[model samples]
Target chain A: MTDNGPCPLQRDAPGQVLSLWWASTGQETAMTTSGRTGDEQAARAERLPQRPVRPLHLQAGALALVLLGGTLGTAAREGLTLVVPEVGGFPIALSCINLVGALLLGVLLESLARRGPDTGPRRSLRLLLGTGLMGGFTSYSALSLATQQLLADGTVGRALAFALLSVVLGVLFAFAGVLLASRRRAGGAR
Target chain B: MSVAVFILLSLAGGVGAVARFVLDGLVRSRVSSAMPWGTILINISGSLLLGLVTGMLGAQLLTPELQLVLGAGFLGGYTTSSTASVETVRLLQQRRMVLALGNLLGTLVVGSAAATLGLVLGAAL
Candidate 1:
């Protein structure tokens, strides 16, 4: 039941046209080809107008926001440093934060995925808080900390294995999160 | 770290994330092939920058400000596993699991390997 009219998909920039050439028989040669010029011109080429003073505004806003987030993360770390002893002899307190964040993100994602996805608050929470904030906060820096500790204890093999496993498992757990979320939705649909 | 240093890191991170968003948007606007080249490119580039930063810092060529600019700012903006994961789920729901899996595993494998490479180069320096 599909008609053969050119599927008019909206281009990003206004006043742009896109027409795909499927037939070499010349039946649909009326569009896309530059009528006046023999050159097979590009189907679409229209630049979106740059916003006046947009870069300046964006630069300022971005600087402010990054400063806010970085300071918050850094201050939190500083406070934690005052509260807790050195983490695995690294003296960096945020190492613990990253580890704890990763674990919590994993667990929370699991629980939310179990709830069966219907685009609820839980799903959004898992997506935003668990995946975005937690994943962002938890750095590979912490994993290196643990690995360093293992090696420091004269367990080179353990350190190597830990290095390999933490990375491999981190990805696997992330994929597992996707699977769980999808399955939950499928279950609900059924 | 002083408040100034803290502000610098945050400022850098914000700019980085926004840059990532803009880059992805620019790419996606043209290529709707469902391949997500933007994510891949951003991540790989981020890893490389991270490597460069690590090497420089280890070599004493970079100060804390440079670290914040590149490590906390640029790489932070360049890489995004969370959005990639969420997008994968959305794709899976729409029965596009192959790309999803590729993205998930690809970022992890590549990102980790890149980090290790960076680490080695850093240590060497």
Candidate 2:
């Protein structure tokens, strides 16, 4: 149900569309149409999700640690090896990571679309684990490296333009995934 | 020790990431309107840092993995365009069209320039 009061996030300016992000009795926290109510406008702050059973939490932490260490360590070693001036200025290690991240993000999203949320908790877990952690690990480092390599190889226009576009559009695609996921979740809640 | 290196890099990455987070918070708090000074500042500064590191590494000056751990790993994570894009979407959803457009345009225009500048200056140094 849409509230008629002004949104808490908005200013006193009239007709200002103040969209309040609130988590209520119902899950998927409805984005209330902007308005305000007395004594009830502190913006819904959801408590952090409870960590799983102790064993699960430990497992998650362990997994996270391993993933973080492994990815970073490999990148560092790769970077060290690629520091030659003859190569691109930026380390090639990051290029490898970046490419991995981009490809994984694409694949994960595609897979999620197919799986299609068997449950809310399951869906959320997938997002938090698969998207946040995994997406973070994989990066456009490879593409960046390729761009640098191309530039070094005297393909200036292609390298610079491609690099610029990749950074620009890579960001847009990530945001798009977030948007698409949220919309899908919201639509399912209906 | 390899362990020492790991601890050091992780600590640096953590501090840099947190700093980026705090700056974003400050930006959001100060400018309720269209300006995303937080991200703009972070990205630009990060680019410069990358440039500085790149220049050194390119010159075979920086020690191995020093640039990777600090520059690529730390700074790359520190600077984010995804957050900016999401904030832009939030502005648009809240019907802040002008703000959204301004944020998008400003970040791209300013960010690229900053990165380019960083490369040039770092190379010079």
Predicted model with the maximum DockQ: 1
Per-residue C-alpha lDDT of model 2 across residues B8-57, encoded as one tens digit per residue: 65445444544454566567666874666776677667766665676677
| DockQ for the candidates, in order | 0.14, 0.09
Clashing pairs in 1: A66-B10, A66-B11, A67-B10, A67-B11
Q: Please name the candidate that would achieve the greatest TM-score relative to the true structure.
A: 2
What lDDT is obtained when candidate 2 is compared to the true structure?
0.48
**What C-alpha lDDT values do all the predictions have?**
0.50, 0.48
User: Best lDDT goes to which candidate?
Assistant: 1
lDDT tens readout by residue for model 2, A108-153 = 4534554454333333333333423443343222333344456667
**How well does candidate 2 score on lDDT at residue A20?**
14
Candidate 1 TM-score, true structure as reference: 0.50
The backbone clash count of each candidate, in order, is 4, 16
